[model samples]
Target: MFKSIAHSLAALSDRFFHRANIRLKLFYAMLALIVALIAAINGAGHYIFNRDFLGYLNEQAQQRMEDMVPRLEQAYREHGNWDFIRGQPRVWFELMKPAIVEHNGVVPPSGPPLTPSDLTGATLRFSLLDAHRQLVIGYPNIGPDARLRPLLLDDTIVGWVAQTPFENVIGAIDLRFQQSQFLAQLIIAVVAVMLAAFLVVRISGVLTRPLTRVARATHRLAGGDYATRVEVESGDEVGRLAQDFNQLAMTLERNEQLRREFMADVSHELRTPLGILNGQLEALEDGVMQPDAQTLRSLKSEVEHLNKLVGDLYDLSLADAGALAYRQTDMDLLPLLRTSVQVYGERFSQRGLTLTAQLPAAMPVHADGARLQQLFNNLFENSLRYTDAGGGLHLQASLQEQHWHLVFDDSAPGVPPEAMARLFERFFRVESSRNRASGGAGLGLAICRRIVDAHQGSIAASASPTGGLRVTVVLPARFEEQP
Candidate 1:
């Protein structure tokens, strides 16, 4: 039995706290408890305080009756002058009305003295009784139901004042006063309980207002409204949590922007080379251009560029999926840098440019050799393609800390400072004024970036001191051996 009760209470508490919808259950429950408590307190106070008020009124009435008793006794004993007592308002009106009796030439042992004030509208009854308890003088109006107050001298009854009909006596109790007090107490308790209930519900609403705001913001977010953020004015935990949520939403929005930009860049890069190849093929088939060696060579070059672009796109997809394989091996950094420069040396020389490579003798680095070679070749090709005629390009390799640093600086009118930030972004080209024919597919640096990143390294571009572009590559000095 006890376990069942505890389980029910626990379930009630869970519903109170965890239920998402506000159907006014808690508010109603709190209001009811507050009202009940207020009524109990007010009821107890009313009973305690007003209990004395009724007693006081009843006591005052009793005291007035007691004070008038002596005056009535004196009126009967001194002179039998009932007129003196009847004429006095304090005695006759407040206490009782006087009654006159005839003695019938005999002294009575006792007689009724007076009638009560409540019997003023009724007929007065007079009676004179002899010492033997026999009535010597009696009025026919003296009914048996009359209430009589007896006059006494030395313990002997002289006469009596009688009021016929008991209705007059019963009316003197004055119960309306008690009823009024009770009504007043009830009114006060009801008003107080109602006021208390109102205040409890109002305060509960104020407390839960923050929760309501948070719920609204969450709903907006669920509808794909990333801009919705909770702005709480208080410094409470809810306020802090709201601030944190807003920050998280902002971060997610930024990441989504980056993702969109990356995709656009990828599409632009792939489409440019494909468009050139398609146009060249259509021209050849239509006989607009002869199938000469030069036209065929142009077609072959565009096709090669398209192939590289597709290959880089494929590699990026693999990298994003965390499926890019890295075959790590210890190799000399200088030989790799020298080899990249050698591959591009003939092309640079043909363009009236100088290719210089500065390498430290035998600095060994741990990396995937094939991927590292690809990284250098991509960077070199970028510099070679963008540099002006007769410009000089520099390649350097050295050990920096526990890592290898390979850098390329070209003295071409390199990428503009404004465009340098996006140089490594896929499909981003710095030469905005250059048309598609001049600007090769722009995925070279992006491919370089992914290759370097897969090796757990960094690559970025800066404005070279030589008034050209400087590309830097930093790779880890050691590697974890593959199992």
Candidate 2:
């Protein structure tokens, strides 16, 4: 039961402390620290001032008492006893006063004689006594607590002077003055604390405003508002954070657009083959078209298209998931390149395009032969489908600087400069139309990119000198192979 109660109390405390917003927490923390610092400074200042000021008053009183000794001895010598000084408060006070003038100004000799009331401000009190230790003059309340000094005449002690330490004074005026000082200090400390708190609140607001914007932007992003952005107002870490956040938002926005396009393209690509097969089967069932070799071949071609699309999608998924199978081998890429060109050279010719090959006898590379064949097939197919009739197709290969460079250049109609960068993006097509009449699911270049990347090579597309798309493939060469 005790453990449960303790846990409940701890949870409640956590809720209380943690429920406050960051701005409030920061403001309170800064305000508390500033107030504590100011309080400590003021407290130390008061302590030192009180100690030093009291010490100075005590020193002055001690000096006055010592000076009174000579004056009392002169009076005693003239009177030959304490009779001249006894029962005279004014005379005792005058005798206690220092002979030298204070630095502020000198007092006139005809000025009013000092009294116990006058010395109260200085925190000093006095009493004069005779040779027999009898009280003569000064404060009636003087006791052994006061310091004593001897008054002498010709080396014989005439009487004793009893003086109070500055600390012993408890007069109303002194108490009132101390209370006023304390009140002033208290007021000053309160004002300082209030001012510090106000400044802390303002500073906390300034600091937390950017964080608030980021939080709001995050909320919007969570709600699928990928277009949300924040303004960067400084060259500090917070500003950098805002910049990074903006970049993240832009990437998310671009991804969202791509995702929508991918879904649409997938649906359209699927529907085309499915619709053709459905229409053909329905026509055959309705006796509108006879089931002949040509009809069967048409259905088979549509099925193959669907199968190819599905296979390409599967390959992409595997590559994205880092699960694509690769059978690496050390082999001559020159023979493989020659075989791919020979296989596609007739297709280029069938389309009335000139296919030229610039070959090297041997180019060695460590790669998957089947994937490399597929990569070359896709590039040739792209040129076959997109290049206009009578255009030229060139296949060039060379080994340079421990790498194999393959260039595929075809004549116009070519892809736009702006479309070149996104040519390798999945489901991206320069045509903007989802029709497959030109024979591609737009996954060919994307698959080619994955193949080259898996081999630790780089691929890029640019404008050819023939005003066509120039595709460059660079792969690390196995230079140790003599063949």
Candidate 3:
């Protein structure tokens, strides 16, 4: 039960307090506080006024009842009681006058013996009650069962007047006026609180709505949606946030612009030399000069290095632009692995690196054939480049759950843990100085990443048990063929 109550309270608080913008939260908080205060004040005012009014009315009723007690006692003492009431004598006319004025203009009948018709509209009526419930009275209007104030005599209980009316004319008038005033005040309080709550809600929404919009824009910006911005309609916190969001978006866009410009600058710096070297090499090969074998070999090697650099740059450019193409097909991967190994057989033999392929006779995969070939080529070249002389390089293919897994393990210096994470970042080199020595322009893994992504697969690098870098590629065994 306690947990249930706690959950209910938590849900209620969440609904009332959790908001998307600070300004909206503040506005709601202030409005709720104001409403609570107003309601408390209104309730207190109603309670006090109603209590005081009822107390005053009750006190006045008791006071008049007490004052009439002595007059009724004197009348009973002087007159002959029940028989005298029918006679209705005028001997006590002066005494009744004061009581008449006190009882709101009600007066007893006077001047000669009066009939019941003559007593009509009088300020007071004299009455008597017998043990048999019979009215022995001056008029029929005051009956034996009529409600009346008790008449006491010298601290002794006596027979009561059966009925009586208020003697003061102004008492009823005053009461009617007080009732009207109280009702008006009560209505005003109710209306005022209701109007105030409504106006507060409307004005708060007007002020905080823009802030909500700006908050959403900021969230989008933080999520790398640089294109998002808000329009400022007022000179306020909301407007300031809008202005800040626009400024932030501009700054991010400009930084991105500068980064693209820097990449272009680097590309131009590397490409210019390759273009010049290629032209010079063509000119030399046209028999412009008869170069020695050693000189020729040196120039050819330089040309090859230049070609590699240009190729790496081109691959990086395509990957950055998301423009790498693929030609996906479903085929057994074993034959493809054999074919790639055969092309690099002479280089592997020369380097004294043992290249071995361990693959299933038939393992089906749906992927781009040419792109997959390029991907494997990069892995093989990377392994051969780093593997020490007489070291072993192994290629394996197998099935793992829904994916076809390809792995390359070589005996070479494994990648450092710190550099492993950034291995696939464009132009990110593990050893900046030594990368060029190994004919690595640092774009191989990046290209492999794009190819794997195009095939909706994953490629990762880890330490192999052979104490070398292990490259693992996993692709879905079958894909819906793209038309």
Best by lDDT: 2
* CA deviation > 4 Å runs, candidate 2: 1-17, 46-178, 200-214, 231-242, 325-331, 349-354, 400-402, 432-436, 478-483
Task: Give the TM-score of each candidate.
Answer: 0.56, 0.70, 0.48
Residue pairs in candidate 2 whose N, alpha carbon or C atoms collide under 3 angstroms: none
On residues 319-414, what C-alpha lDDT tens digit does candidate 3 reach at each position? 778876666777777788889998887789998988888887776787778788889988888877877788878888888887988888988677
Q: What lDDT does the true structure give each of the candidates?
A: 0.67, 0.83, 0.69
How would you order the candidates by TM-score, starting with the best? 2, 1, 3
Quickly count the clashes in candidate 1: 11
Which model, 1 or 3, shows the larger lDDT?
3
Flag regions of model 1 displaced more than 4 Å. 1-17, 22-211, 232-236, 255-263, 431-436, 478-483
lDDT of 3: 0.69
Better-scoring candidate (lDDT), 1 or 2: 2
Task: Please write out the lDDT profile of model 1 over residues 230-284, one tens digit for every residue.
Answer: 8777888878878887887788777778788778876777677778888988998
lDDT of 2 by residue, 1-483 (tens): 999999999998577557878766776676678778867987887777669866666666666667677888888888788777666666766776655555458665665555343454542376777877678887657765687888777777779887776666667987898899779878877887788678768887888899999999999998999999999998898899999999999999999998899999999999989999999999999999999999999999999999999999999989989899999999888888888878888888899998899988888789999999989989998888888888978989887888889999998877877888989998888873222377688999999999999999999999999978899999999968477
Model 3: weakest 10-residue lDDT segment is: 114-123
